[model samples]
Target chain A: MNIIMSKTITYLQRVEFGDCDPAGIVWFPNFFRWIDAASRHFFIECGVPPWHETEKTTGVIGTPLVDTHARFVKTASYGDVLHVRVHVAEWRDKSFVQRYRIERVNPDKTGDEMTLIMECEEVRIFAARREDGAGIRALPIPAEIRALCS
Target chain B: MNIIMSKTITYLQRVEFGDCDPAGIVWFPNFFRWIDAASRHFFIECGVPPWHETEKTTGVIGTPLVDTHARFVKTASYGDVLHVRVHVAEWRDKSFVQRYRIERVNPDKTGDEMTLIMECEEVRIFAARREDGAGIRALPIPAEIRALCS
Candidate 1:
């Protein structure tokens, strides 16, 4: 079992008007979506995209989160391009834990430094797939993913 | 200035798929969208059709969210239909506060018991509109809405 699969922080931005709330602040849910997207992007860089690209790919199938926790540090507004950093904190034969830090890059937008939106940690399982691809299975992480991420 | 021309309490259901995270639990952000939808629904129930019909009739426009806060308690999972109950917590001159509670309803989905899952508290402000309907205007809340929620 491993506590952390890999640790290479990643970044992204917040665009689109729907990201904001009626109060003009970045709606909290968008933060989670950003974090998830960044983690997926990291995997893509590691050669295993979050979603299986090739049918024979020995990659994650469901990747359902078992638990999620986050803390809000500051406020984010519409049109703010923020930085999303992700790292694998813990890993096991069956599952792994990942964390995220969201910060504000353009102070003029939210008019602040940090503006910590969330410090998030999610525990997820590598959902398994059946031979016929009808139901789910819980399989161990593949060696290539582990090696790349590690 | 008023966001919806009225303050009202709104309610919504927690569907099975609405739980989007792998944790089999409700993700933090989905609650905000539910609250926002319920708020828009509240206006329509109060005779202010929000999306398509009313906005075209009255030159008065809706305000966007500037800030929000939410707290999670117990978890809800598959087949659990949640009840999102909203109330006007504070009705100020330029802005008002809305409080929400996500109750885990019985399997029958009656909401008669209203078993509690979590609660959320958020505040929103209203701005006076510009002549071109593009700029900001600061005005007092309408008397009718205040009377209803006050």
Candidate 2:
């Protein structure tokens, strides 16, 4: 069997004061925010059209997260430059797993050392608008979309 | 063995337009944000002092999440009033499990029907400032705090 590996994408951002809590460290929820953004960026970088366009033509509105697990490794603070490495780990019939590794550059360390801030794995589905127009339902993985991402 | 259940606290909030994405549904990370707020509200309702006070008195800074698992059940949109019910599920020596059930009232349905939007279970620890003040370290579960919550 020929196995194709999903492409990896790196998203970069600087931690801001508003992103930190009273403890002077980055608030945990902000990590989820960045991770979500990274997930979207990965798809966009892989040549997938925006969800709005897909919703019109392919009935695919967006990838909605169904399950997630996360682990926090180290603390980060304002002014820190962070990077989120994102990739699709697996593609199932109607769902896929996305993984993220968040890291921060260590200024005091030599030779480009980085500290791991957090890691997360999320299961998401290609969602289509429901007939009642109130919610969404999962759709089977589209071959074209999968080809573009892989 | 006698098992004592922790008291539950409900936090209510209104969804704002900014909390949503272009798809017009509530962004998933906003759920994590609300859950974090509900966790703190649970401690407040249980008579625990704010983290700053605890830091000075007991050296306990705040409860920081180490791990989490979440399942999104339904979609929500702006202007919806959401209720997050939170409680401690288990207490360990250095960490504890906090659970949240997020729901919304459905006016279109009769008899005060509510819709479950998501559920989450988080493992957190009461953290103390490290000696060098650069990061945090887990602390043993405080008896007084546990008693108040239970």
Candidate 3:
């Protein structure tokens, strides 16, 4: 018997004029915005319920980012169609490494070729509402969620 | 003789409702958005012209992020006033380290101090429009820009 250890999910987005800055290219922060959305989408695609639901069932409020590193390889502008591919790179005891690769699809006669725009690796934690309710704290990686994602 | 090597600039922002997530907390990506704005505001406060103007005089378009590391210490919500303090942590030949500290101020008479929401350190480059006009390329630190930021 063979078992798949990890899975990748793709999230699509259309670049809009509002996403660009005065330089006529996508503002860097917009990339992070899409990445965050993609992160959630990955979980959804893996059959995980929304954070609100998980909050009550497992005391997991959400996955809050602990650290991130990103590299912008190319620039994107309005009218571009981007595909954000997300996956869990590693599952730690209390945190996991979420990785993303954003690409711009170029449609041509020779078929579509994807241009690499940016890549990022982030450390995130499944968080539970703090006892005092002031903020959140990291929770141990849930077995059910990890099994679904894997 | 003493020389001031770096200067810090603070940018003020009002947390808007749309900036929050379904959890009623400021979404993480919005932090990056404000940091980007604060980065630009820092240069503007230091007397650097806007990127469009600098693009004409010097081929410099804008500072683009190459690498970044951030930690979220506390969560924020709508109706809060945030102060983002930005400064240069290191000056490289072709890239510089820009640092940011975001704080939520509590102005009650009880003297409760401000809360640190997040902190980030980003490696960015002085970007110039590529000769091929496709994307941007890193440029050596311009003396005038360095002098202003310093």
Q: Which of candidates 1 and 2 is the stronger one according to DockQ?
A: 2
In lDDT terms, how accurate is model 2? Answer: 0.92
* Predicted candidate 1 versus true structure: per-residue lDDT over B39-93, tens digit per residue: 6666556554453432354333554444455555555665677777776777777
Which regions in candidate 3 have their CA more than 4 angstroms from the true location?
A1-4, A109-112, B1-4, B109-112
What lDDT tens digits, residue by residue, belong to model 2 across residues B51-79?
A: 99999999998898899999999899998
RMSD of each: 8.6, 1.8, 2.7
Clashes of 1: 19
Local lDDT at B98 for model 1: 72
After superposition, the stretches of candidate 1 with alpha carbons farther than 4 Å from their true spots are A1-10, A17-28, A35-80, A84-150, B1-10, B49-60, B108-112, B127-139
Model 1's i-RMS, to one decimal, reads 6.5
TM-score of each: 0.54, 0.94, 0.90
Best by TM-score: 2
lDDT of candidate 1 over A21-112, digit per residue (tens) = 55445666677678768777766776666554522476455565555666655566666778888877776888787778887775564555
The true-versus-predicted C-alpha distance at residue A109 of model 3, in Å, is 5.2
Poorest 10 consecutive residues by lDDT, candidate 1 chain B? B51-60
Candidate 3 chain B: worst-modelled 10 consecutive residues by lDDT: B106-115
Which structure is stronger by lDDT: 2 or 3?
A: 2
